[model samples]
Target: MTSPLSHLATHEVTNQPPAPGDRDLWAGDIVLRQAIARHGGQPGALEPYARALGTAAMQEAARDANRHPPELHLFDRAGRRLDEVRFHPAWHGFMQLSAEAGYAALPWEEAPGGHVTHAAMVYLASQVEPGHCCPLTMSYAATPALRTTPALAPWLEKLQVRAWDPAIAPMTGKRAITLGMAMTEKQGGSDLRANATTATRDGDAYRLRGHKWFCSAPMSDGFLTLAQAPEGLTCFLVPRWLDHGRNPILIQRLKDKLGNRSNASAEIEYDNTLAYRVGDEGAGVRTILSMVHHTRLDTALAPAGLMRAALSEAHHWASHRSAFQKQLIDQPLMRAVLADLALDWEAALKLGLKVARNFDGTADEHRTFARIAVALAKYHNNKRAPLVIYEAMEALGGMGYVEDTPLPMLYREAPLNGIWEGSGNVICLDILRTLAKEPLAGEMLNAELQSVTGTDRRFDAALKAHRTRWPGLPPEAEARWFAESLALLLQGALLIRHSSDAVADAFVATRLARGSGRIAGAISGCDTGAILARIAPVE
Candidate 1:
C-alpha cells in the first residue's frame, strides 16, 4: 500500500514494512486474550483501554513525552519557593488518559477481577509508554497500604475517582490524585533501617527533616516516605501542599537517568516537611510491604509487554523484507529466532497474570502462592527480556538501532523493571527466604510444579533434577540457579495445562530440557509454524 504519487517519484518505496501506527493491542493479541480468559480475568474490561493505548496519536505522544523530558522549576519570578517539575503536555495527556482508563483506580474501584485486569492494563500501557506507568503503579499499590491509616480518609476517597486532576491542590480540591513512594535514601539503597531522615513528633503528626535520594513524580499530591522516629524507622505520608502553603520540600535536582525519561525522578530534601505517620512506629517495612508486593506484579508483567512490542516489530519487518530470493520470515534460521522469542514472551505473560489472579486470594494456598510466585516471575521474566529485545533489534539489521522505530525505547525500558523494587540478587535471596520461612509457600509452589508432572517427561526430569540438586535450600550462591529452575518449571506447568500442545512441547524441549544453546533460538526441532502463529505478520 503506497501513495498514488509513488510512480511520480524517482523510485517507489517498495519492499518496506508498513508502520505499526494503527495496531489494536487487545485485538491483535490472541495469546493475551486466551491467557486472560484462561486465568479467569475479564478481557471485556480491558478492551477499551487497550484499544485507546494502541492508537497512533498515543504512540506519537509516548515518543514526544520521552523526547522532551521534565524540567525542574525551582523558584517563581517573585523569589517565593516553587519547587515543581514541569513535564511536556504529552506526559500530562497520557497521565490523564491512563487515569481515566483505571490504570490506578481499577483495583480499588472493586471489580471482581480488578487485580487481574489491572495487571493486563500494566502490560498494555508499558508497551506504549512505560515512563508514565511508575506513578500509576505506586498509586495502585498504595491503596492497601493506606488502609491502615484512618487519618487520610479524604485522600483515600479521592483514590476512587477514575479521572486525572493534575491541579496542584489539596485532595479536597481535586477530583482525582496520585501517590508516590520515597523510601530510598542516600545511605540505604534497599536497606530501610539505614535511613537517617529523622521525624520528630508533632501534635497530630510529625515533622520530617531529611533528604530523599529519589522522589519520583515529584509533583505527586503526596508521598509515602520513611524516616527515623524515636521508636525506630517509621513510614509517613508527606503531602506536597499544606493548607497554609507548600511544604518545605526542596528539589535538589532531577535524575538524568538511562531510561524512563517521560517520568521524573528527583533528589529532594524534606526541610521540616509536615507529615502524618502511616502505621505503627518501627513497622515501616511491614507497612510498605503491601505496596512492594503489588508493584512487583507490574514489574513482572512489564518486560513481557516490552518483549511483545519489540518482537512484533521484528516479525513485521522480516515478513516483508526480502533477501537472497526469499522473504526473511521464510528463512529457517530467522523463524527459529522469532519462535524462541515468542516462547519466552508467552510464558512470561501467562505466569504474570496467573500471579495477579492470586493477589486477592480467598484461599490460604492462593495467598501464599502469590507471595512467592511474584518474586519468581519478576526475577525470571526480567532476566530474559533484555536479551529478547536485543535479539529482536538485531533482526532488522541497522534500521533497528535508529529512532524511526520504537525498538530503541523498548530496549531502554527492558532492563528498568528488573532494577525496580528488587534487583536480581535481592529477588533471588528473597525467593530463598520465602521458601524457607513459609512452609505453605513451598507446599503451594510444589503443588503448582507437580500438577503437570506426569504429562511431560522432560518437565518431570527437570523437576526431579531440581529437587535432587539441592535436597534442602541451596546455598546463597546457588539462589539464582534455584530461582531460574523453579520459574521455568512453573512456566512449563502452566503451558502444559493451558497452551496448545505445540507451545507446551517447544517450551519443554528448549527451556526445561535445555534443547537450545545460550542464545535466543538454537533449537533444532520445534513446531516453528505453530509457535510463529502466536504473532501475526503485517498484511
Candidate 2:
C-alpha cells in the first residue's frame, strides 16, 4: 500500500466532437444533390456556395445569430414611436448570404429548375439557420399574390432582388426587401372568418384598425394582412412606411417563442394603417391561398432540412464517439437507430422534391396532384420531424442535451414547421376537403401511385388495402389516420421509384408491410449498412 505506482497516472481520454465544416453541404447530401440533378438544376454554383455555408466560420455565425436572438425596439429613446426590431449582426450576415444564394430569386426568375431548385436552396440554408427563412419564404410566396394586384406589382421586382439590405428605411432606399404576413387574431386562431379587424376605403388606399394576434417577422417592409371590409374579409398589403409618414403599425410586443429566436414575431396593432387592397374585396382567403400554398411547401421542406442536419450530427458523433472500446456506430442497436432515422429522412426528401417538381409543371394533372400531395407531405413530414430529431438527440446521449450542441436547437425548432402553415388536424382536414370537392383528386393520387406499379409487392398490397377500405373508412374523425396512410403510401412509391434497393426495401418492409414497430430501431432483415451509407453527409 505504501509503495504506490507514482508514475502510473491517469490521463483524460478525449473523444472530440465532430468538426462541422471542411466539406460541401450540397455535395455531401447525396439524396438532395441527386434530386437537384433529377429536377434539372445545374448545381454548378450551388456546390461551392453550399460549401461556403458549411464552413466552421459560417456555422459559428449561425450559432451566434440564434444565441443572441433578435431584440425588439418598440420606440426610440426620445419616444418618437419608432417600431423596429434589432438583430445581431450575425443574423444580417445570414440574411445577406441566403438572399444572394437565390433562395427567393429563383422562383420569380423562372430559373432552370424554378420551384424545384428554389426548394433545394431553401433546404440547404435552413440546415444552417431557419429563422431568416420566414422572411425569405414570405417574400418568395408573395410574388403570385402580388401579381394579382397591380398596386403591389412594382414591389415584386424588389422582392426578387438578390441583395438583402435590412435597413429600416423606405423601400425606395433599399436595394431589396423581404415580406411578412398577419392573418390570425386573438378571437380567430384557425378561423380567419372570425377576425375582428376592420378596413375602410380611403381614396386609393385603405385604413386598417385591428390587432393581429400573431404577426411573424414584424420588421418586414410589408405585410399581407386579412381584415374585414364592407364587401367581406379582404386581403391588404400594409407597408411599413409611406410618402406621408410611417404607417401606424404599432408593435405591441414580441412572442417569446421556444425556438427560432433569431426572428422576431410580434403582436401588433394597426391604427389607421395605410394599406392597399390585394384582391377582390370579398375573396381574401382565395387571394392569399396561392401564397399560402407556396409557403406550406416551404414549411414542409424546413423539417426535412432540419432532420438532415440532425442526422449528420448524430452520424458524426456516433462515428467518432466510442463506448466499451468500440465506436457507437459499429454497435448493433445504435446502427439500427441511425439507419431507421436515415430511412425516414430519405423518404421525406423524395416526396418533398416530387411535390415541388409538380409545382414546376403547368399541366392540369400536375396542379391537381400538388393540391393533395402538398397537404399530405406537409402533414406527415412536419409531424414526424420532432420524433426523428428527438431520437437523433438521444443517439448522442447527454452530449445532445447541452446547449453547446446543435441538436437541442434542432429539437426546439422541429415542432415549428408543423405548427406554422397549419397544424396536423388542419392539414388533414384540408386533405379531406380537397378529396371531397375535387373528386378527381383520388384518381390523380392513384394514377401517380400507379406509375410505380409492381415495383414492390408490399406497396401494392398496401395501396390495394387502402382502396378497398375507402368506403368503410370514416375520414372525418379519422382524418389523421387517413393522412398518415396517404403519406406512407406516397413515400413508399417515391422510394420505390428513386431510392436504392436497401432504402426502398426498408421503407416497404417497415412502413408498408406492417413490420415496423412504434419506435425507431425496430426494423430487421433490411440492409442497415446500405441505408446508412446512402445518407452519409460526405463520402
lDDT of 2 by residue, 1-539 (tens): 15323343575437765455564788688898888888776587578668878887888888899999888787788889888889999999888888887888877786666888778777787788888899999989988888898767668879989888887777777789888999989988988899889999999989999999999888888999999999999999999877667888999888999999888999999999999999899899999898999998898788899999899989989888889999998999899999999988998888898889888878888888888998998899998899999999999899889887788889989999899878889999999889888877788888878989787788899999887877643458889988898899999988887889999998899998989798999878888899899778773
Query: Largest lDDT belongs to which candidate?
Result: 1
lDDT of 2: 0.86
Shift in Å, residue 284, candidate 2: 0.5
- lDDT per residue (tens digit) for residues 402-469 in model 1: 98888999998898999999899999999999988999999998898888878989999999999999
Q: What is the C-alpha RMSD of each candidate to the true structure, in Å?
A: 1.5, 4.0
Ten-residue stretch with the least lDDT total in model 2: 1-10
| Native-to-model Cα distance after best TM-score fit, residue 491 in candidate 1, in Å | 0.6
lDDT value, residue 33 of candidate 2: 85
Model 1, residue 135: distance off in Å is 0.3
Each prediction's TM-score against the native? 0.98, 0.96
Q: Model 2: runs farther than 4 Å from truth?
A: 1-11
Among all candidates shown, the one with the greatest TM-score: 1
